[model samples]
Target: MAGEPQPSGAPTKGGWITFPFLIATMAGLTIAAGGWTNNIIVYLINEFNIKRIDAAQIANIVNGCTALFPILGAILADSFFGSFTIISVSSLISLAGILLINLTAILDTLKPAPCENGLTVCMAPSKTQLAILYTSLALSSMGLAGTRFTLATMGADQFDNPKHQGVFFNWHFFTMYAGTLVSVVGIVYVEDNVGWGLGYGLCVAANLIGLAIFVVGKRYYRLMKPQSSPFTGLACVIVAAFRKRKVFLSSKSEDYWQETHAGGTKFVKTTPTNSFKFLNHAAIITHGDTTSDGFIKKPWNLCTLQQVEDFKTLIRIFPLWSTGILLCTPLAMQMSLVVLQALAMDRHLGPTFQISAGTMMVFVMLSTSISLAIIDRFLLPTFEKLTGTSPTPLQRIGVGHALNILSMAISAIVESKRLATARSHNLHGNTVVPMSVFWMVPQLVVVGVGEAFHFPGNVSLYYQEFPKSLKSTAAAMVAMFIGIAFYLGTAIVDFLRKTTGWLPNGINDGRMDNVYWVLTVIALINFGYYLICSWLYEYQNVEKNELSSSSPCPC
Candidate 1:
């Protein structure tokens, strides 16, 4: 019974848990590298004397590259190399880039000081050094793109079986968030205090560590090699369409032939057994069928034009879901602009306490990590029992969106108060707010709660909903959503500065309270949109169906 007819290519028990952890570790490292850069922008400006605009531009370039290349990586993974190989190659590439960056930094440090005071004079990097920096950033971005999609899809592969699948995804998402928590807390701090080289180097190390873990668990991994291209399916759909036309014509001819053969006898209108059989297999349409015209017609098959039309018909019936892009926008800000904004706030912990913006992220990360662990270990099971329906990943995603709305609301209010306090004290000229640095705590805590809700839920949701052939594409879309949000946020900031006469004396002028208020308002608007989207979202329970029903393998 234990070995009773199982789903196609389902992994054994051991592979399920290990796969998620491996992916989580890689994700954690990527976020850490990004996070370190975010928190240390101010330090980079102050210590290196790099212009703020130049620093911001560099960061934007890195983000843009990171977001853009994932699509290509996903394509490669889905069409050519398998996820494991992609992950392996990407890890090595990222490691090499990080090492080069470290070497550059060390070289900079070793250069002779120009001042008699013996203090190291900051100098702009030479063209060669700058080119190296850009190259390293690009390489890291490429590597991340190559691996991100595969890991998520591979993690989902662990629970291909139906029985243990119920709580399987819950654990999967929990591990991912747990990993993020570690990156935000441990890795972000390391980057902020230690310097950029060390920060990126640590990220590389984390990637290597994750790769090692995956290597050791090779036997247990439920790996899926890339399948045939979507274009192949599209070609099949075209063939099927032509065959469908032929079938219709043939059916008409058969009806006419039967009428003539009756020869004055009344023809009994009997339904064909084959037609009834086809009806019985309607639920199995996603698999496909051999058509009368020598073409295989899969359910929602993209193989022929008619099949493509059938697929469209199926899509039309799907529930109207929230715009995932809008839902993801505010959540994406937490990693990018939010970090930069937090650093702008006075982060001094007073004489007795010392905390930088990057260090403060530890609290948020720890809180989120704890929350994720609890949710997986306890909350998910309890909710399942109470609701009588295991929460679909989309439902979990909705919860995340709701949390983000609340987090943004809190951020707006707290920031408003901070701004008011600063303005009343005539401290507008001060870059750092005079209020206790602890004033930002509420915002940070709320962000933590929001993170716990959104990140894992969305990842799991995308993995579950997307077809196996498009899993990498789906994952890349998630990354793209974040990138779009970041770009939009940056654009909005720029527009506000230009139109409202905001940043009156430019970014370094330090009177940025108005900008904060504007961003807070923007956050509120995003929260409202997210709420609407969440309410409209439809949930899909991929785990309930037998794996044989939906598994990618033909066998």
Candidate 2:
């Protein structure tokens, strides 16, 4: 039923044949994206002579923009060009942006001179240089927004069977993690040791190759045409209800206007539920609301029962969704803060080898990749065997909340120890702390493990609970919330800088430990809030029994 070709302009029949192209493209694009973004703070500090705190702020904003753009890209795809066109054009845009970045790395004139030996002060870039850099970053972020999750949606669209879709999603995530791992470790190493120009040039090449691969697979893709935006349908329900505010509520199934399937069967055979009864007005049939054949004549004044139900579903899930914003904010802050910490600490792996500050996230990626395998192969099966039921997505999310709180506490403890060591040695204002960067590994690994549980759980919960028409948007929702969290992180950082001595250009002179402690407290409060929301939440589309039996994989 899922794989069959639809009526003219809908997705056509496509299957596993399209997997290699999409997967390969995802891998290349991810690697290319990481090549630039992973080491951005270091780049700004070293090449552009920006202060460490300012560079971290810029990195947060770039990360926020990159995450937020997907919602817009999804809207455009669902409303106008469709996924194939969007992905293709976006890849080209990314390639162009990367080329510009590479040029900046190659041409010394495009950047301010590097700070001279043993000097804290450095020259700032000119306005023209800043403009070039900003334009490149904007284009790259926009390109990334267009392709990232849309590719997943398009790949899933190719398969008709749920099992096949599950396998595709697993592979999709695997490829993505692998790409990021390689780029963060490998590409960052190249940028730090070899040359930034060569590092960004590789990114440009990867983007070109990935784009070519995707285009070559055009014939194999089951391209879905742009349809009316699901967002529009949801808005119509609200508007229609407001206009019919004085109308009496009714429980009768026959009172509401229902659309028919192709075979003349009612699209939504059941009457509206009592929950959010105000929205039911949108479906109440009124004189002249529809034509003789039951088609809507006044789109804003009338909606099908299905549209009303979809709006209600989103409303029901709003509280649970809001909790994720706060839950993610601490993690976003930790991500950037850890980078600054890594920059100021010892990163040696051996006598001749040194780890790049940006590559410190490799611990998180490595832990997540390994933990996902362990969960899928060991923990999940063991839990099901012991309890005679699989763990629910909410349960997984709850576990993640606990782990995140613990991770923040660990980070605070480690930062305090690092600060004590710095003070004892009188290392204030020094570029590198006397402490080892590996001291940060435990917290990084803990948070990565937390992500292993929560991210997939959130994805699964959203995809399963969202209305059928909004499945693509469901995939992008995670990105949207994470984007909001990054913006919040930026605000939190700015607020702290203005009000406290927790962050400075040189963290060695500031109370970095205090920042981690504050984050720990915030995470603790957020976890409690998550517990309350999860407890109050009830699954609408998925039964508890069904949820307990479903695979923990995102699909």
Clashes by residue pair, model 2? none
lDDT of 2: 0.84
- How far does residue 213 in candidate 2 sit from its true spot (Å)? 1.0
After TM-score superposition, the amount by which residue 493's alpha carbon in candidate 1 deviates from its true location, in angstroms, is: 2.6
Q: What ranges in model 2 sit over 4 Å off?
A: 1-13, 263-269, 543-555
Model 1 per-residue lDDT tens digits across residues 1-555: 011233789555444457556655555555545443444455445444554544554555566556656776666666677666777788677667656655655566522222233233456655665677667667766776666555655565566554555344444444444555566566666666666567666766776676667677666666665765564554454454444442422222122111112223223443222322222122212223535543334533323222243334224223322344455444444444444445556666556544556555556665676666667668877987899876665566566666656666666566567667666666643255555657666666766666566655555555565544444454465666666655665565566557775444223243344554554565556556655654665433336422111111000
Model 1: residue 84 alpha-carbon error in angstroms = 2.1
Each prediction's TM-score versus the true structure: 0.68, 0.95
lDDT of 2 by residue, 1-555 (tens): 123246898555578889999999999999999999989999998899988888888888888888888999899877888888899999988888888999999999999988997886779999999999988988898898889888877898888787787788778878887898889988888999999999998899889989999999998888887888889989999999999989997777778978756744374547998888899999898888877775778999988898999998898888878778777888888888888898879988888888999988888887877888888789999998999998888898888888888888899899888888888888876468778999999998998888888887887788788988898787688788888888998999999999998798878888878887788888888888888888888887755422222222210
Candidate 2 residue 147 Cα shift, in angstroms, is 0.8
Model 1 lDDT, full chain set: 0.52
